[model samples]
Target: MDLPHFSILISDKQYRKLNRNIWSEKPVEAELQIEDKTFDVDLLYRGNHVREFSKKSYHCIFPEITAGIKEIHYNAEFMDKSLMRNKLSLDFFSSIGVLSPTAKHVLLSINEENQGVYLQLESVDRNFLKRRKLPSGPIYYAENDDANFSLHSPIDEDIKDSFDSGYSRKEGSSRDDKTLQELIYKINTLKKTEFERAILDYINIDKYLRWLAGVVCTQNFDGFIHNYALYRNSFTGLFEMIPWDYDATWGQDINGEEMEFDYIPIEGYNTLTARLLDVPTFRKQYAKIFEEILTYHFNKQNLYEKINVMHNTLRPHVLRDPYVAKFIDDFDREPGIILKFIDDRHHYLRNHLQDLR
Candidate 1:
C-alpha cells in the first residue's frame, strides 16, 4: 500500500499539560478515511516534519513510551539535565565511531518559565528508516486509545517475535540459554541478520547480549527500540548504535547515571568501550570510553575542558542559552538517585581501573 507524505489532524489540544508530539496547527492536507485504525498514521503522536515556526524550537518526537513508569515531580528537573547527558552521550558516540544522528537541532528547550520544556520537533529521515529497518520491519503507530491505559509497541513486538517462530512472549516460555542459543542461530541466518553473519555464533549471540545491555540502558531511557536499523548509523556495515524513544526518558531513574555504567553488565554494543569499561572486563571501561568519546567530540569542536569530562559542559554558547544553561541549577534542585549511582559505578571502576590498563 502507498503511504502519504502527510497526515490530517483529527483533533488536537494545547495540552495545557502534556503533548508529546509538537506540530504547528495550520490545516490538514491529507485525504483520509479511518479504517480498522491502520497502524500507519499520516499524522500521529510524535510525527516529525520540517517547518519554520516563529518559535523555531527543535524537538525530537519520541513516538511512545514502553515502560510502566509513572511520572514524578521530584525528578522532573532531571529531564533538563539528562537532555544534556543524552546529547553528550550522542556526542560521545560520535567521538568514537557511532555516526547516528548528530542532532544539529535542539531536542528540548526550557519554556519561558523553565517550569517545563518546549520540545522541538524535527523530521525523521526516511532513509534513516531504511538503514535501521528490522528484519521483522516497522510497525505502524497510532496515538489514540481509550482510557484503557494500555501501551502498544511495534518494536517490542518484533524483538519479542524474533525470539519465537513468529510467536511472541508467553508465560510458559523460559528464555534460558537453550532458547537464547537457538534464537541467535536463527538470527545469524536471517536474510538481513540484525547482527553479523561474518562473525561466529558466539559473536552473534554477543550482539543480542549487547542488546540486553541496551535494554538496561534504555530502561533508563524508558524507550525500547522502535526503528533501530540505524539505532546509530555507522560509517560501515558494522551496524551503528540506535537510540529511539524519549518522553519516558529521564523520568525513570532517580539518579541519571545508568547510561554510563550499563555496559558494566554488557547490555550495549561491542565497542572498545564495553571491552574496557565493563565490570566483566578491564573495568576502566566507563571512564576510558567516557574520556575517549568526550575528548573526541570536544576536540572536534576545538573546545577543551579537562574537568569531569563525562559531566563536563563544552559549549559555552549552549551554556549561555537560557534553556541549555538551566541543566546546572535545575540539576541541583533535582533529587537524583544518580549521586548514589555515580558512587556505585565509581566504586566499581575505582576497584578495576588498574585492570583496564
Candidate 2:
C-alpha cells in the first residue's frame, strides 16, 4: 500500500510570513487534510538547526479536530541520509518492551507543492499514555543537553530555579519539582549499598536496563543526555525512560558522522546509569539484557531485513524529493552504510558482551 498522505493548506501571505521567521513559535492557522478528513490545525515550524535547513520540520496541534490525540510531529529527517533511522530505532525500543512514540513515513504537501516524505511521530503526551494503557503521571521533556541527572550541590535550589538540568514538566499541576528533586537527591546522596537496595523504588530498574540496552545497541550517544522523556508511573510510583529523537542512531552521530559502535560503554550515559552499573546486580542484569537483545532484536539479519523493507518503501518517495536531492549526493547508497553499521555493531556486541562488567 502507498504511504499515508497529508495535504496542508495555508494562505500565501501566511506562508511567506512563516517562511520569514521559521523558528518562531507563533503558529499559523492551517487546514490539514488527512485520511479523507479535514481538520483545523495550528502549524508551527519546529526544530533548532533543522529549521535553518531547506526543508523544515513542523509541529501540528489539532485542538478541536482530534479528541484523543492533541498533536503530532513531522520530522524533516534532514541529517539522516537513510531517513529511517528514527523510525527504526523507535521500533527497536518498542520490540524490547520499552515505551516509545510510534513513527511512520508519510508524504507531505504544503500549498499543493510536494515537500517530500516525512516521518510522522506520535506526540508523547497524556493521550499517548492512554493509547498505550499506561498510567498518566507527570511527563518531563528533556530540554537541554545537560540532562545528566548529576550530583550537583544545591540540587533542590536548582530544581526550584529551573536550572538547565535539562528537564521541564509537560504535565501535572505541581508547580514545584519535589518529586524529581527527591529522586535526584536519593540518586546523589544515598550510600552506594543503600542506593542499590532502594534504586528500584524510585525508578523502574528492569525497564531502564532495557532502555539502556536499546541505546547502546543503536549507538544513540545523544539519547542518554537528551532527546528523551521521563515520566512517573502513578501506579508503579517510579520514573521510566522513554526514547525520543533518534535520527542519529545505527552507528551514526547526530551530524551524520561515522561513530565507533564498540566505543559506547555498556554502562551507557548519565549519573543514574553510572550508579546503576556500580551495583554488581545491575551490571549482571545489563549483561543479560544485552545478550537477549543480540539474540533476538539487534542481530544483523533482523536489522538488515528491516532496513531493506524501509529502503524499498522509501526509495521512490526519496527519489521524488528534490529537497533531499539538494543535500544528499546519492540517496541509493545511503542504505548500504546503515546495513554495514548494523552488521559491524552486531559483531562487536556479540563478542564484547563479556566485557560489560
Candidate 3:
C-alpha cells in the first residue's frame, strides 16, 4: 500500500519569503516532482490557525498540471488523528449526490524532507466544474461566519455594509455578486410566504437539503455557516453547495478532541438553514433526506466498514510520520471511537427526526 509521493523544490529565498508571512495567500515559485517528472508550481502556506501548527498545510497552483487540475491542496491533517476524516466526509457527500472535491492520502516532501502523509484535495474552481462535465457557473467560497446568509454580521450583529461580506468569488463575474447579494437580501427580508416561493428561484432546494443532510450526518459544526462553496448552476439558475475542509468531523472537534455526538443539532446552525426549515415543505423534505441518510449512509455498519478500511489503509503510514508516530495508539483506537459515535449519533438523529415530522 505505497502512497503516491510528491516532492517540492523551492529556492531558499522563496521558501524564506513564504515563511516570512505565514498568513499570506501569495504563492512562491517552486517545482514539483511527481513520479520522476517535474512541473512548475506556485506554493504557499494555507489554513487559518493550522498555519501555526508544527505541521502546516499548503496550497499549490500549477499553471499546467493535469488536464483539469490547475490547483490542489496538501492538507497536513494536523488536528485529525485518523487523517481520513476529510476524505470520508467528502466521499459521503459525493455518494449522496452532492458535489464535493476529490481527495486522497499522499506523502509530501519539501526541500527533500519528509513532511509525512498529506491529504491532497482538488481545488473548487472552474476547473472542478469542467472536470465533472457540469454546467459552468459562479462559485463562491463561504469564507467566514459572515457567510451565514444574514443581513447582519454574525460577529457583532451590525448590518453588513457589503452584501458579499463573507463570500469570496472563486469563479464568476460581477453579476454573480449581485445575484448572491439579491439572494441574501431576499432570504433576510422577504415575507415568509414570499420567501418560501422565491427561494426556489435562487437555490436548488433538493440539492441544498441533501447537502444539509450530509453536513448534519457528518456533524460538521462549522459547515452550515462556512467551509462550503456555493455554485450557481448555469443551466439550473440555482445555487448548489459543495463541501470543503472537513477535518473536524465525525465526533471530533477542530482541536482533535472528542465531541459529543449531539453537539450539532439535527437541523444544523446558521440563518440560511433556519430560514429553509421554517417552511413546512422544506422541513419535510429535509426530514426525509435525513431519514434516508441515517438508514443508508450514517449507520454503524456502513460507516464502520468505511472507517475500518481507511484506518487499515493508514495503519502502515501512521507510524512512519514523526508527527503522528507518538499518537499511533490513539490512531489505532479511532475506528472504534468513531464507530461508537456513529451508533450514538444515529440513535439521536432517529429520535430527533420525529420532532422534525
**TM per candidate:** 0.38, 0.94, 0.98
Q: Write the per-residue lDDT of candidate 1 for residues 196-219, one digit (tens) a residue.
A: 333333222233333333333323
Top TM-score prediction, candidate number:
3
- Candidate 1 vs candidate 2, lDDT winner: 2
lDDT, model 3: 0.91
* Residue-by-residue lDDT tens digits, candidate 2, 1-357: 478899899998888887888778999889888878888899999888888898889999887638689998999998888898999999999999899999999999997899998999998889999998988898989876657776542334343333336687888656436778778778878899999988888899999999999998899987887889988899989888999999998878978888886768666878889899889999999899889888988877777778888888888788788688554455567678877887888888888888776
Off by over 4 Å in 1: 1-43, 47-83, 104-184, 187-238, 246-347, 350-357
Query: What does the lDDT read for residue 284 in candidate 1?
Result: 35
lDDT of 3 at 100: 95
Q: Which ranges of candidate 3 are over 4 A from the true structure? A: none
Regions of model 2 farther than 4 Å from truth: 65-67, 152-164, 326-329
Q: Estimate the overall C-alpha local distance difference test score of candidate 2.
A: 0.84
Give Cα distance to truth, residue 30, candidate 2, Å: 0.9
Candidates in order have lDDT scores of: 0.31, 0.84, 0.91
* Models sorted by TM-score, best on top: 3, 2, 1
